[model samples]
Target: MTKALKASGFLGLAVMMAVGLHQFVILSGGSAVPPWMIGGHAHLGVLSILAIVMGFAVPALGVVGQLRTAVTGLFIAGQWGIPGIVWLGEGFGLTFLMPTGFLWGGALIASMLIMLYKTVTTEEAGGGGRAGVAPADD
Candidate 1:
Protein backbone atom coordinates (compact mmCIF):
# COMPACT_ATOMS: atom_id res chain seq x y z
CA MET A 1 0.00 0.00 0.00
CA THR A 2 2.81 2.42 0.85
CA LYS A 3 4.43 1.67 -2.45
CA ALA A 4 1.18 2.30 -4.25
CA LEU A 5 0.69 5.64 -2.52
CA LYS A 6 4.22 6.78 -3.29
CA ALA A 7 3.86 5.71 -6.90
CA SER A 8 0.62 7.57 -7.22
CA GLY A 9 2.21 10.60 -5.62
CA PHE A 10 5.07 10.61 -8.10
CA LEU A 11 2.68 10.15 -11.00
CA GLY A 12 0.57 13.03 -9.79
CA LEU A 13 3.64 15.22 -9.52
CA ALA A 14 4.61 14.34 -13.07
CA VAL A 15 1.20 15.31 -14.33
CA MET A 16 1.33 18.52 -12.32
CA MET A 17 4.67 19.42 -13.85
CA ALA A 18 3.24 18.91 -17.32
CA VAL A 19 0.29 21.08 -16.49
CA GLY A 20 2.61 23.72 -15.07
CA LEU A 21 4.61 23.79 -18.30
CA HIS A 22 1.40 24.14 -20.23
CA GLN A 23 0.47 27.06 -18.04
CA PHE A 24 3.82 28.64 -18.65
CA VAL A 25 3.37 28.32 -22.37
CA ILE A 26 -0.01 29.96 -22.18
CA LEU A 27 1.44 32.83 -20.15
CA SER A 28 4.37 33.29 -22.48
CA GLY A 29 1.96 33.39 -25.41
CA GLY A 30 0.27 36.37 -23.69
CA SER A 31 -3.02 34.65 -23.05
CA ALA A 32 -4.52 34.79 -19.58
CA VAL A 33 -4.48 31.42 -17.85
CA PRO A 34 -7.85 29.92 -17.13
CA PRO A 35 -8.91 29.71 -13.49
CA TRP A 36 -9.65 26.02 -13.67
CA MET A 37 -6.20 25.21 -14.98
CA ILE A 38 -4.55 27.09 -12.15
CA GLY A 39 -6.85 25.47 -9.59
CA GLY A 40 -6.24 21.99 -10.98
CA HIS A 41 -2.50 22.44 -10.90
CA ALA A 42 -2.62 23.52 -7.26
CA HIS A 43 -4.82 20.60 -6.27
CA LEU A 44 -2.59 18.11 -8.03
CA GLY A 45 0.53 19.44 -6.37
CA VAL A 46 -0.93 19.52 -2.87
CA LEU A 47 -2.61 16.12 -3.06
CA SER A 48 0.50 14.55 -4.44
CA ILE A 49 2.44 15.70 -1.41
CA LEU A 50 -0.34 14.48 0.85
CA ALA A 51 -0.26 11.03 -0.72
CA ILE A 52 3.51 10.81 -0.37
CA VAL A 53 3.42 11.85 3.28
CA MET A 54 0.54 9.56 4.10
CA GLY A 55 2.46 6.63 2.66
CA PHE A 56 5.02 7.00 5.43
CA ALA A 57 2.51 7.91 8.11
CA VAL A 58 0.08 5.04 7.60
CA PRO A 59 2.26 2.22 8.83
CA ALA A 60 3.48 4.22 11.77
CA LEU A 61 -0.15 4.75 12.73
CA GLY A 62 -0.65 0.97 12.59
CA VAL A 63 -3.09 0.95 9.70
CA VAL A 64 -3.00 -2.53 8.17
CA GLY A 65 -4.79 -5.22 6.23
CA GLN A 66 -8.07 -4.30 4.56
CA LEU A 67 -8.33 -0.86 6.14
CA ARG A 68 -4.95 0.16 4.81
CA THR A 69 -5.94 -1.04 1.38
CA ALA A 70 -9.16 0.93 1.42
CA VAL A 71 -7.47 4.13 2.55
CA THR A 72 -4.82 3.76 -0.12
CA GLY A 73 -7.45 3.31 -2.79
CA LEU A 74 -9.28 6.40 -1.64
CA PHE A 75 -6.10 8.44 -1.59
CA ILE A 76 -5.17 7.45 -5.13
CA ALA A 77 -8.65 8.04 -6.43
CA GLY A 78 -8.88 11.51 -4.94
CA GLN A 79 -5.33 12.36 -5.92
CA TRP A 80 -6.40 11.96 -9.54
CA GLY A 81 -10.14 12.34 -9.54
CA ILE A 82 -10.52 15.90 -8.25
CA PRO A 83 -8.20 17.55 -10.73
CA GLY A 84 -9.23 15.24 -13.54
CA ILE A 85 -12.84 16.14 -13.02
CA VAL A 86 -12.01 19.81 -12.90
CA TRP A 87 -10.08 19.64 -16.15
CA LEU A 88 -12.81 17.63 -17.82
CA GLY A 89 -15.58 19.92 -16.71
CA GLU A 90 -14.03 23.36 -17.03
CA GLY A 91 -11.66 22.63 -19.87
CA PHE A 92 -14.38 21.16 -22.07
CA GLY A 93 -17.26 23.20 -20.59
CA LEU A 94 -18.88 20.10 -19.18
CA THR A 95 -20.30 21.81 -16.14
CA PHE A 96 -22.28 18.82 -15.03
CA LEU A 97 -19.15 16.96 -13.99
CA MET A 98 -18.00 19.69 -11.64
CA PRO A 99 -20.15 18.66 -8.70
CA THR A 100 -18.88 15.12 -8.80
CA GLY A 101 -15.42 16.31 -7.88
CA PHE A 102 -16.70 17.05 -4.41
CA LEU A 103 -17.32 13.37 -3.91
CA TRP A 104 -13.69 12.64 -4.60
CA GLY A 105 -12.59 15.40 -2.27
CA GLY A 106 -14.88 13.98 0.39
CA ALA A 107 -13.29 10.60 0.01
CA LEU A 108 -9.87 12.08 0.57
CA ILE A 109 -11.07 13.90 3.65
CA ALA A 110 -12.69 10.78 5.00
CA SER A 111 -9.54 8.78 4.49
CA MET A 112 -7.53 11.33 6.45
CA LEU A 113 -10.11 11.38 9.20
CA ILE A 114 -9.95 7.63 9.45
CA MET A 115 -6.20 7.77 9.80
CA LEU A 116 -6.47 10.49 12.43
CA TYR A 117 -8.96 8.40 14.38
CA LYS A 118 -6.74 5.37 14.15
CA THR A 119 -3.73 7.31 15.33
CA VAL A 120 -5.56 8.80 18.26
CA THR A 121 -7.08 5.50 19.32
CA THR A 122 -4.02 3.36 18.80
CA GLU A 123 -2.44 2.20 22.02
CA GLU A 124 1.31 2.20 22.40
CA ALA A 125 3.17 -0.80 23.73
CA GLY A 126 3.20 0.81 27.13
CA GLY A 127 -0.61 1.31 26.90
CA GLY A 128 -0.38 4.95 26.09
CA GLY A 129 -3.29 6.47 24.14
CA ARG A 130 -0.99 8.16 21.63
CA ALA A 131 0.80 6.32 18.90
CA GLY A 132 4.61 5.98 18.46
CA VAL A 133 5.54 6.83 22.01
CA ALA A 134 5.59 4.55 25.02
CA PRO A 135 4.68 5.86 28.45
CA ALA A 136 7.57 6.48 30.80
CA ASP A 137 7.95 4.05 33.67
CA ASP A 138 6.63 5.31 36.99
Candidate 2:
Protein backbone atom coordinates (compact mmCIF):
# COMPACT_ATOMS: atom_id res chain seq x y z
CA MET A 1 0.00 0.00 0.00
CA THR A 2 2.81 2.37 0.88
CA LYS A 3 4.51 1.75 -2.43
CA ALA A 4 1.23 2.20 -4.21
CA LEU A 5 0.63 5.52 -2.54
CA LYS A 6 4.11 6.70 -3.36
CA ALA A 7 3.75 5.67 -6.97
CA SER A 8 0.46 7.48 -7.28
CA GLY A 9 1.95 10.56 -5.72
CA PHE A 10 4.75 10.61 -8.27
CA LEU A 11 2.34 10.07 -11.12
CA GLY A 12 0.14 12.89 -9.86
CA LEU A 13 3.12 15.19 -9.65
CA ALA A 14 3.93 14.41 -13.25
CA VAL A 15 0.42 15.26 -14.33
CA MET A 16 0.43 18.43 -12.26
CA MET A 17 3.65 19.52 -13.91
CA ALA A 18 2.14 18.99 -17.30
CA VAL A 19 -0.86 21.07 -16.38
CA GLY A 20 1.40 23.81 -15.04
CA LEU A 21 3.29 23.93 -18.29
CA HIS A 22 0.06 24.19 -20.17
CA GLN A 23 -0.99 27.06 -17.92
CA PHE A 24 2.27 28.82 -18.61
CA VAL A 25 1.81 28.42 -22.31
CA ILE A 26 -1.68 29.88 -22.17
CA LEU A 27 -0.53 32.84 -20.09
CA SER A 28 2.43 33.47 -22.32
CA GLY A 29 0.11 33.69 -25.28
CA GLY A 30 -1.95 36.38 -23.51
CA SER A 31 -4.82 34.03 -22.82
CA ALA A 32 -6.61 34.09 -19.48
CA VAL A 33 -6.30 31.02 -17.32
CA PRO A 34 -9.40 28.87 -17.40
CA PRO A 35 -11.17 28.19 -14.11
CA TRP A 36 -10.92 24.47 -14.56
CA MET A 37 -7.19 24.58 -15.17
CA ILE A 38 -6.61 26.72 -12.13
CA GLY A 39 -8.69 24.51 -9.86
CA GLY A 40 -7.27 21.30 -11.23
CA HIS A 41 -3.67 22.48 -10.82
CA ALA A 42 -4.17 23.55 -7.24
CA HIS A 43 -6.01 20.39 -6.17
CA LEU A 44 -3.66 18.07 -8.01
CA GLY A 45 -0.52 19.68 -6.56
CA VAL A 46 -1.81 19.69 -3.00
CA LEU A 47 -3.30 16.22 -3.10
CA SER A 48 -0.16 14.81 -4.65
CA ILE A 49 1.86 16.11 -1.74
CA LEU A 50 -0.69 14.71 0.70
CA ALA A 51 -0.51 11.32 -0.94
CA ILE A 52 3.27 11.24 -0.62
CA VAL A 53 3.22 12.31 3.01
CA MET A 54 0.39 9.95 3.85
CA GLY A 55 2.37 7.10 2.36
CA PHE A 56 4.56 7.18 5.46
CA ALA A 57 2.08 8.59 7.96
CA VAL A 58 -0.63 6.03 7.29
CA PRO A 59 1.55 3.10 8.26
CA ALA A 60 2.69 4.93 11.35
CA LEU A 61 -0.93 5.36 12.43
CA GLY A 62 -1.09 1.64 13.16
CA VAL A 63 -4.02 1.01 10.87
CA VAL A 64 -3.79 -2.37 9.13
CA GLY A 65 -5.65 -5.01 7.16
CA GLN A 66 -8.87 -4.15 5.39
CA LEU A 67 -9.30 -0.78 7.07
CA ARG A 68 -5.97 0.43 5.81
CA THR A 69 -6.73 -0.83 2.37
CA ALA A 70 -10.02 1.02 2.30
CA VAL A 71 -8.46 4.23 3.52
CA THR A 72 -5.69 4.05 0.94
CA GLY A 73 -8.16 3.36 -1.80
CA LEU A 74 -10.26 6.35 -0.83
CA PHE A 75 -7.22 8.59 -0.78
CA ILE A 76 -6.14 7.54 -4.25
CA ALA A 77 -9.59 7.77 -5.73
CA GLY A 78 -10.18 11.20 -4.29
CA GLN A 79 -6.79 12.41 -5.36
CA TRP A 80 -7.54 11.72 -8.99
CA GLY A 81 -11.29 12.05 -9.12
CA ILE A 82 -11.63 15.59 -7.85
CA PRO A 83 -9.38 17.24 -10.44
CA GLY A 84 -10.22 14.88 -13.26
CA ILE A 85 -13.89 15.56 -12.86
CA VAL A 86 -13.31 19.28 -12.66
CA TRP A 87 -11.32 19.29 -15.87
CA LEU A 88 -13.97 17.28 -17.64
CA GLY A 89 -16.80 19.41 -16.36
CA GLU A 90 -15.57 22.99 -16.40
CA GLY A 91 -13.28 22.66 -19.36
CA PHE A 92 -16.09 21.22 -21.43
CA GLY A 93 -18.84 23.33 -19.85
CA LEU A 94 -20.53 20.31 -18.32
CA THR A 95 -21.58 21.75 -14.98
CA PHE A 96 -23.29 18.55 -13.89
CA LEU A 97 -19.92 16.97 -13.17
CA MET A 98 -19.32 19.44 -10.33
CA PRO A 99 -21.29 17.40 -7.82
CA THR A 100 -19.29 14.30 -8.53
CA GLY A 101 -16.09 16.23 -7.93
CA PHE A 102 -17.39 17.37 -4.59
CA LEU A 103 -18.19 13.80 -3.71
CA TRP A 104 -14.59 12.87 -4.35
CA GLY A 105 -13.48 15.70 -2.12
CA GLY A 106 -15.79 14.41 0.59
CA ALA A 107 -14.32 10.96 0.32
CA LEU A 108 -10.85 12.40 0.72
CA ILE A 109 -11.92 14.30 3.80
CA ALA A 110 -13.54 11.21 5.29
CA SER A 111 -10.34 9.23 4.90
CA MET A 112 -8.32 11.94 6.59
CA LEU A 113 -10.76 12.13 9.48
CA ILE A 114 -10.65 8.40 9.97
CA MET A 115 -6.87 8.44 10.21
CA LEU A 116 -6.99 11.37 12.59
CA TYR A 117 -9.48 9.58 14.83
CA LYS A 118 -7.36 6.47 14.96
CA THR A 119 -4.23 8.43 15.79
CA VAL A 120 -5.83 10.45 18.54
CA THR A 121 -7.44 7.44 20.18
CA THR A 122 -4.37 5.25 20.26
CA GLU A 123 -2.05 4.62 23.27
CA GLU A 124 0.94 5.58 21.20
CA ALA A 125 -0.76 8.84 20.41
CA GLY A 126 -0.09 9.83 24.01
CA GLY A 127 3.60 9.18 23.42
CA GLY A 128 3.75 5.80 25.09
CA GLY A 129 5.01 3.64 22.19
CA ARG A 130 3.74 1.74 19.18
CA ALA A 131 3.78 1.52 15.39
CA GLY A 132 7.32 0.13 15.46
CA VAL A 133 8.63 2.65 17.91
CA ALA A 134 10.65 0.98 20.69
CA PRO A 135 9.55 1.60 24.24
CA ALA A 136 11.98 2.78 26.88
CA ASP A 137 14.11 -0.09 28.24
CA ASP A 138 13.39 0.94 31.84
Candidate 3:
Protein backbone atom coordinates (compact mmCIF):
# COMPACT_ATOMS: atom_id res chain seq x y z
CA MET A 1 0.00 0.00 0.00
CA THR A 2 2.86 2.32 0.81
CA LYS A 3 4.44 1.69 -2.54
CA ALA A 4 1.11 2.08 -4.29
CA LEU A 5 0.52 5.31 -2.43
CA LYS A 6 3.90 6.66 -3.46
CA ALA A 7 3.29 5.71 -7.06
CA SER A 8 -0.12 7.37 -7.11
CA GLY A 9 1.21 10.47 -5.39
CA PHE A 10 4.01 10.74 -7.92
CA LEU A 11 1.61 10.16 -10.78
CA GLY A 12 -0.68 12.82 -9.40
CA LEU A 13 2.21 15.23 -9.11
CA ALA A 14 3.23 14.49 -12.68
CA VAL A 15 -0.29 15.07 -13.95
CA MET A 16 -0.47 18.32 -11.97
CA MET A 17 2.81 19.45 -13.51
CA ALA A 18 1.44 18.59 -16.91
CA VAL A 19 -1.56 20.75 -16.14
CA GLY A 20 0.76 23.63 -15.39
CA LEU A 21 2.67 23.03 -18.59
CA HIS A 22 -0.57 22.83 -20.47
CA GLN A 23 -1.52 26.18 -19.05
CA PHE A 24 1.79 27.59 -20.19
CA VAL A 25 1.23 26.23 -23.66
CA ILE A 26 -2.21 27.72 -23.82
CA LEU A 27 -0.82 31.04 -22.68
CA SER A 28 1.82 30.85 -25.38
CA GLY A 29 -0.82 30.41 -28.10
CA GLY A 30 -1.18 26.65 -28.20
CA SER A 31 -4.48 25.05 -29.19
CA ALA A 32 -7.51 25.90 -27.06
CA VAL A 33 -7.53 23.85 -23.88
CA PRO A 34 -9.61 20.73 -24.31
CA PRO A 35 -12.28 19.83 -21.77
CA TRP A 36 -10.82 16.39 -21.27
CA MET A 37 -7.45 17.86 -20.40
CA ILE A 38 -8.87 20.01 -17.64
CA GLY A 39 -11.14 17.26 -16.32
CA GLY A 40 -8.40 14.65 -16.39
CA HIS A 41 -5.95 16.91 -14.65
CA ALA A 42 -8.34 17.57 -11.79
CA HIS A 43 -9.55 13.96 -11.48
CA LEU A 44 -6.07 12.50 -11.41
CA GLY A 45 -4.84 15.03 -8.88
CA VAL A 46 -7.70 14.30 -6.46
CA LEU A 47 -7.69 10.54 -6.92
CA SER A 48 -3.96 10.40 -6.34
CA ILE A 49 -4.41 12.10 -3.02
CA LEU A 50 -7.21 9.64 -2.25
CA ALA A 51 -4.91 6.73 -2.98
CA ILE A 52 -2.33 8.02 -0.54
CA VAL A 53 -4.93 8.57 2.16
CA MET A 54 -6.40 5.14 1.62
CA GLY A 55 -2.95 3.62 1.93
CA PHE A 56 -2.67 5.04 5.41
CA ALA A 57 -6.22 4.17 6.36
CA VAL A 58 -5.97 0.58 5.14
CA PRO A 59 -3.39 -0.42 7.69
CA ALA A 60 -5.09 1.58 10.35
CA LEU A 61 -8.24 -0.38 9.68
CA GLY A 62 -6.34 -3.70 9.56
CA VAL A 63 -7.32 -4.55 6.00
CA VAL A 64 -5.20 -7.37 4.67
CA GLY A 65 -4.67 -10.13 2.11
CA GLN A 66 -7.13 -10.25 -0.77
CA LEU A 67 -9.27 -7.41 0.48
CA ARG A 68 -6.26 -5.19 0.76
CA THR A 69 -5.03 -6.21 -2.67
CA ALA A 70 -8.39 -5.51 -4.29
CA VAL A 71 -8.74 -2.14 -2.66
CA THR A 72 -5.24 -1.07 -3.52
CA GLY A 73 -5.25 -2.42 -7.06
CA LEU A 74 -8.61 -1.04 -8.01
CA PHE A 75 -7.87 2.35 -6.51
CA ILE A 76 -4.57 2.66 -8.30
CA ALA A 77 -6.04 1.48 -11.56
CA GLY A 78 -8.83 4.01 -11.36
CA GLN A 79 -6.45 6.79 -10.40
CA TRP A 80 -4.16 6.18 -13.34
CA GLY A 81 -6.37 4.54 -15.92
CA ILE A 82 -9.29 6.97 -16.09
CA PRO A 83 -7.22 10.09 -16.65
CA GLY A 84 -4.88 8.20 -18.94
CA ILE A 85 -7.75 7.09 -21.13
CA VAL A 86 -9.15 10.58 -21.19
CA TRP A 87 -5.82 12.08 -22.08
CA LEU A 88 -5.23 9.56 -24.82
CA GLY A 89 -8.73 9.69 -26.19
CA GLU A 90 -8.86 13.47 -26.30
CA GLY A 91 -5.31 13.87 -27.46
CA PHE A 92 -5.80 11.40 -30.29
CA GLY A 93 -9.51 11.96 -30.88
CA LEU A 94 -10.32 8.36 -30.07
CA THR A 95 -13.84 8.32 -28.70
CA PHE A 96 -13.73 4.56 -28.25
CA LEU A 97 -11.49 4.85 -25.23
CA MET A 98 -13.92 6.99 -23.29
CA PRO A 99 -15.95 4.01 -22.12
CA THR A 100 -12.81 2.42 -20.81
CA GLY A 101 -12.19 5.51 -18.77
CA PHE A 102 -15.66 5.28 -17.26
CA LEU A 103 -15.09 1.66 -16.37
CA TRP A 104 -11.87 2.47 -14.52
CA GLY A 105 -13.45 5.44 -12.83
CA GLY A 106 -16.23 3.22 -11.57
CA ALA A 107 -13.77 0.72 -10.25
CA LEU A 108 -12.05 3.40 -8.25
CA ILE A 109 -15.30 4.45 -6.68
CA ALA A 110 -16.21 0.88 -5.86
CA SER A 111 -12.92 0.30 -4.11
CA MET A 112 -13.39 3.37 -2.00
CA LEU A 113 -16.83 2.27 -0.92
CA ILE A 114 -15.58 -1.17 -0.09
CA MET A 115 -12.79 0.29 1.96
CA LEU A 116 -15.23 2.43 3.84
CA TYR A 117 -17.54 -0.48 4.46
CA LYS A 118 -14.74 -2.66 5.67
CA THR A 119 -13.35 -0.04 7.94
CA VAL A 120 -16.70 0.78 9.42
CA THR A 121 -17.60 -2.87 9.97
CA THR A 122 -14.21 -3.60 11.46
CA GLU A 123 -14.51 -0.82 13.95
CA GLU A 124 -18.06 -1.79 14.75
CA ALA A 125 -16.99 -5.36 15.31
CA GLY A 126 -14.39 -4.18 17.82
CA GLY A 127 -11.33 -4.78 15.70
CA GLY A 128 -9.02 -2.02 14.45
CA GLY A 129 -8.87 1.40 16.08
CA ARG A 130 -11.06 4.18 14.87
CA ALA A 131 -9.54 7.42 13.64
CA GLY A 132 -11.17 10.02 15.89
CA VAL A 133 -13.10 8.31 18.67
CA ALA A 134 -11.02 8.23 21.80
CA PRO A 135 -9.54 4.88 22.82
CA ALA A 136 -10.68 3.49 26.12
CA ASP A 137 -8.13 3.92 28.89
CA ASP A 138 -8.34 0.29 29.87
Highest TM-score model number: 1
How many angstroms is residue 138 displaced in model 2 relative to the true structure, after the best TM-score fit? Answer: 30
The estimated TM-scores of all candidates read: 0.87, 0.85, 0.80
Residue-level lDDT of model 3, residues 56-92, one tens digit each, is 8888778888888888888888888888888888877
Residue 103 of model 2 has an lDDT of 81
Error of 3 at 25 (Å): 2.5
Q: After best superposition, candidate 3 residue 8: deviation in angstroms?
A: 1.8
lDDT of 1: 0.91
Give the poorly placed runs of model 1, Cα more than 4 Å off.
125-138
TM-score of 2: 0.85
Q: What's the best-to-worst order under TM-score?
A: 1, 2, 3
lDDT: worst 10-residue window of model 1: 124-133
Candidate 2 worst ten-residue window by lDDT: 122-131
Q: Clash number for every model?
A: 0, 0, 0
Alpha carbon deviation, residue 87, candidate 3 (Å) = 1.0
Displacement of residue 120 (Cα, Å) in model 3 is 1.7
Tens-place lDDT digits, model 1, residues 1-138 = 899999899989999999999999999999999999999999999999989999998898899988899899988899999998889999889989889888898989888888988988987655555778799999
